[model samples]
Target: MQTNDAFSFLMAWAAAPFRIGSVTPSSATLSALMTKEVGPDTGPVLELGPGTGPFTRALIEKGVRENDLTLIEADSDFAAMLTKRFPAARIFEMDATGLRHMALYNGPVLGAAISGLPFRLISPRRTRLILEGVFANLRPGASLYQFTLGLRCPIDQTLLDQLDLRATRIGHTLLNFPPATVYRISRIPVTKSYDWRYA
Candidate 1:
């Protein structure tokens, strides 16, 4: 990571530790783990809270075209920086929870989403809104990759059940500051109901 990036991250963290989540940018190891399952084939990608664009860089390296990226960042400075760094990407300087109301695309066209949001600090209700908004724009079988510093999944089980979603631990990296674990959050597959009378 660049020194300026680290300084900017530290400043952001100092302003609102809970909102920023970490005092430094994610390490390359963690970035790789978070994006390991996504590639060019993933189609248009969505990224939430892309501070300093570490994971965003990894996505491009994984062959996801710059134009295929839609970044949602609340911080003004970070949003401005991202625009300059990724001119081809669609950078939206707005709260991610508002995604459900916004028409980011014509429909559920996003194939995957990677999140750097601080879920552990957010309230369950707000978390639900964020998840609902994100999943609203994701195609079936698509997933949202989220990383947390907590030992367990940051999203509670009740909320997952409420949304008919599931979380699976994909990987973790100690190389990252304070360490972090990546979870793949996807909608549970729906099975057709059986009809004994027909049989």
Candidate 2:
């Protein structure tokens, strides 16, 4: 991470520790792990809370086009910085929960999403709303990659079941400050029911 980015993150965290979640920008190692599964072929990507654009840079390195990225950052300063840093990308200065009410694309065309939001700090109700919004914009078989400092998945199991979603631990990196684990959250495929008589 650059010195300026770290300073900016520190300031943001100081202002709102729960919202910023971390004292510094995400490490390169964690960013790589979060974006490894996505690339140009993944089509449009959505990123939540991309503070300082660490994962955004990683997504670019993985071959995702700048214009294909849509970033949702509630922090005004970070959103402004992202606009200047990635002029081709779309940056929204709004809370991610608003995604449920907004249409980011023509339809569910986004192939993937990367989230840096602090699920651990957010209430379960809001977490469910956020997940619902994200999945509503994702294409079939697409996933939302999230990293958390918690030992287990930050999303509650009850909420996951209610949403018909599942989370799998993709990987973890000790290099990041406080260390973090990445989870791939995807919707469970619905199976068609057959009539016993028809069978």
Q: For each candidate, what TM-score against the reference?
A: 0.99, 0.98
TM-score of 2: 0.98
Q: Which ten residues in a row have the lowest lDDT in candidate 1?
A: 95-104
Cα RMSD of predicted structure 2: 0.7
* Cα error of candidate 2 at position 152, Å: 0.7
lDDT of each: 0.96, 0.95
TM-score of 1: 0.99
Q: By summed lDDT, which 10 consecutive residues of candidate 2 come out lowest? A: 149-158
CA RMSD per model (angstroms): 0.6, 0.7
Rate residue 29 of model 1 by lDDT. 96
Separately for all candidates shown, the number of backbone clashes (residues 3 or more apart, or on different chains) is 0, 0
Which residues of candidate 2, in runs, are more than 4 Å off? none
